[model samples]
Target: MVDVYWRIGMHGDQSTLRRRAETRGDWAPLAPGHLAPGWGDGHGDGRPYLEHMADVARAAEISGFVGGLMPSFPFTDDPFAAAASLVEETRTFRFMVAFQPGFVHPWGAARLSAALQQLSGGRLVYNVITGGGGPAQRWWGDEVEHDRRYARTAEFLDLLRRSWAPRPQSADGEFYRLADAYLPTDLADQPFPEIYFSGSSPAAIAAAGPFADYYLSWLEPHTALTEKFTAVRAASQALGRTPRFAVRIDIVSRDTEAEAWEVVRDGFSGVDLTALAEGRDGDSVGVARARSFIDGPVRDVRDLEVEPHVWGGFSLLRGGPSFGLVGSHEQVAERLNGLVDAGVDAFILAGVPHLEEAFRVGDFVLPRLTHHSPQGALS
Candidate 1:
């Protein structure tokens, strides 16, 4: 069965206008001649950072999600630190902490992953991310070309695996070199965290086949996803390995299809076009593919229906993983199940306000889908 996971927000609150206004602060008034609604102007509930994170973590855990994905970004709190802090907040749900390859040395990453696995009682997973694009790469002082980034990532993963081996191991790769590196803390037979990797480029697929335990893709049409899965499967087969497949996407499910569309319209009503354009101007293959959906014939909010239930309205506001499934609960479930039929083994999903939507999906959609329990072995 496909295992389902939720995306945990490490930044500001993700509530809608009504919820934010009720719990946070009053909304700003719309000015004359403005086409968008006045939102995101409220003073939030003033919860401490840790307190908010704990609430989200507990909600997702109790809601039957297998895990939560904590992303690594220049702006958000450090994923490792946040995951470590959140370990005590939840019991069963795993934390897929995003770790960039070149940002830290492979030895350090292996050590950190081991420590986190111990600390969380084997509830840690690693989402290995190669730098996103030119701007984000520059921010991290990584000037390597696109393909070289994946090459470095391949070397990094190779070293990380060796570093976690029971005995001391060493590696001399193009981007990393280590001599007799070993973790001091005993893992006590605990396996290393599962490696979840994401990239759409050829270099990424080439690297992923050798190392990735789960290959992740942003939401795309069934045809596109089938092609990608075939490519990755073929690449991994060449190496005598078969990596599992996973997908990450947003969801806006409601009681009825019309209600879901209403929610989308309201959510994007206040979107800033300039900010959206800036986000779309990324060089990554994933970014380019997502932008293509919006750049096609469906160029306006009213035309975001890319498929029966899949919506590209979010692509106008966000960059990576911008597509979303929007419809009634049953409709959304059908779309997700279709992906599962097409070979997606896992789903990493999120909505605008994670806390509430975790419950919504857990109570409504999850029970309707054929999914594994949190502790069940993934297929």
Candidate 2:
């Protein structure tokens, strides 16, 4: 069975792709006064930040998505706090909380996740991120190099699993020292959160080999994506483990192909692709691979079409996951099934206005899937 997750916009969202100057949920008022963009007219929806996020989670829960991915960043609300807040609003809707291992100690993370699992009845997953070494690391005051950061993550995950055991666990590793560490019986009994690890580097895969339940990647070309997954699976299997593969991709699905293209007909005409690529500030191999997709200039929007229906203009518009599907529902679904055939068992999908797109994809695209069932949380 394949699982599909919607991305929660913790960093705020705009109403349209065309008009993005004003974001609704960044640092300031999350919902801004009372009116959300589509909430309409003279009256206001009157939702605060957490309330708006609950609505987003509820939308995904009802729209056949298995869960919502709450991404963490310096500028955004804590994914753990955001995910914990929604347990009352949603049932059976898993929360994929993204976090770097260094931020919270493995034992503390275990306690938090176990409490969440107990509350939400095992509706939790993890998107373990090792920081992309750059200024972001500097801001975090982490002087660890690229390879060592991943090594720390591997140690962190190993300890995390051990911390879940009822018996006392001890480890004296390079980055951390634990003496007789163990969770309470009830907390330890709560199912350990399944991990979906992200990294485009060899060290990342090596870390994922022993502990990850899913090896995750941002969407790339089908061929490259297949090759990457092949390597990941081989490494995991060699470690005597079996990890699944997942990809994150944004979408622009519409009733017809023409309507989808019309959403960004002149997207690249005025924008400088080189300047956009150069302006990116992360040191991630995945980022580099995604940026490399747009090698030449841009006279038309079609110039960024790296593959059939896969558009690269998303990097010009957003921060993460540069390539995404931009076609009619049928075309997008076809491409999705193609990716599945190439060995993807899961997906983290997103759109411009998250709440609205949750319903749109559920209504038009999900039914076309080869392995889909309407997976709403029980009311």
Candidate 3:
């Protein structure tokens, strides 16, 4: 049976939005500014983001989510700093931090990972993000070519392993070099934290082959997913490793299928098609791949629905992980079970009104899944 892991994608809510939503005692809000300018609550206000992450981590624990995924960007709070703060405030919930190769050296990242693991009592997980947007890369003083990013990523992970290895260690890779240096001798019995990466590009999969513990991706149709996994598995096999699979989805669960679709309908009622088109056309390789799939072979995203309960609306609007298995609790479970039929082992799902939707899914649907398969059903 596959273990069902749940995490919330708490991408920032604007400041005004945060103020309104914070009325709930259980709600804690995070804003922009902790990382870079031009993001978060105030439009370009230089407010720090640590407050938001700390608040969200507290709320996630209250909401029954196992952890919070801190998105990495020049425009967001530094994930390592944010995680350190949150770990002190919470006891159980985990902190998953995203990092890109170009932004931080592997040794520096490994050091941060070890410190957080010790400070948090093993509640830290690393989200290994290969560089994505061309513009974003330029902002970092790096004009990395698309495919080369993944190659660097592979080298980065190799360096990390060497840096954090058990004893005296050294490694030389195409992108990095280390001398006869070993990690601090005090750190023992330190398990390598879970590594998660997302991309549809072939180079991305090949790069992730040896190191990633969990291959995360944007939700795709069942048929398309089967093919994607086939390639991923083959790549891992070529490296003589076995990696688990996970997905990020935006779910809308209601009492009935019709009600669920209505929630989706109302959510998108204000979405400007023109703006969405403009954003989609914006140059992000991840978005480009997603857009290509939607417009290319998979012309209409609706056609990619593997079951009645599953819908690819989010994928259409956003890039990477966009598809949500929307419907009644039972219907949603059935669709999720289908992924188990293929080889998916974990799901990281979220919704628009995150806190409330999490309650609905956790209280209602999670129990059914637990009852049906106490040890995790998707075997």
**Could you give candidate 2's per-residue lDDT for residues 148-173 as a string of tens digits?**
98999999998888888779888898
- In candidate 3, which residue pairs get closer than 3 Å at backbone N, Cα or C atoms, i.e. clash? 30-52, 32-40, 34-49, 218-321, 315-322
Error of 3 at 158 (Å): 0.7
Candidate 3 lDDT tens digits, 1-379: 5544444333344221112232221123323432322344554454344454455566557656677666676555467777786788999877778788877777777777887777778888878887666566788777778788889998888888778855766677777777664567544356668888777789999998998898987776556667778889999998899988987766767788787766556545544444324444223555654444444233343453545656655633332254677788877776666566566777676664445555667676665553243233222
lDDT of each: 0.76, 0.81, 0.64
- The better-scoring model by lDDT among 1 and 3 is 1
lDDT of 2 at 377: 9
Compared with the true structure, what per-residue lDDT tens digits does model 1 show for residues 60-147?
Answer: 8888899999987787767788888889778998999997798888888888788888878899988988867777778888888889
Q: How do all the candidates rank in terms of TM-score, highest first? A: 2, 1, 3
Model 3 alpha-carbon miss at residue 103, Å: 1.2
Question: Largest lDDT belongs to which candidate?
Answer: 2
Q: Which number leads on TM-score?
A: 2
Candidate ranking under lDDT, highest first, comes to 2, 1, 3
Q: Global CA lDDT of candidate 3, please?
A: 0.64
**Clash pairs, model 1 backbone:** none
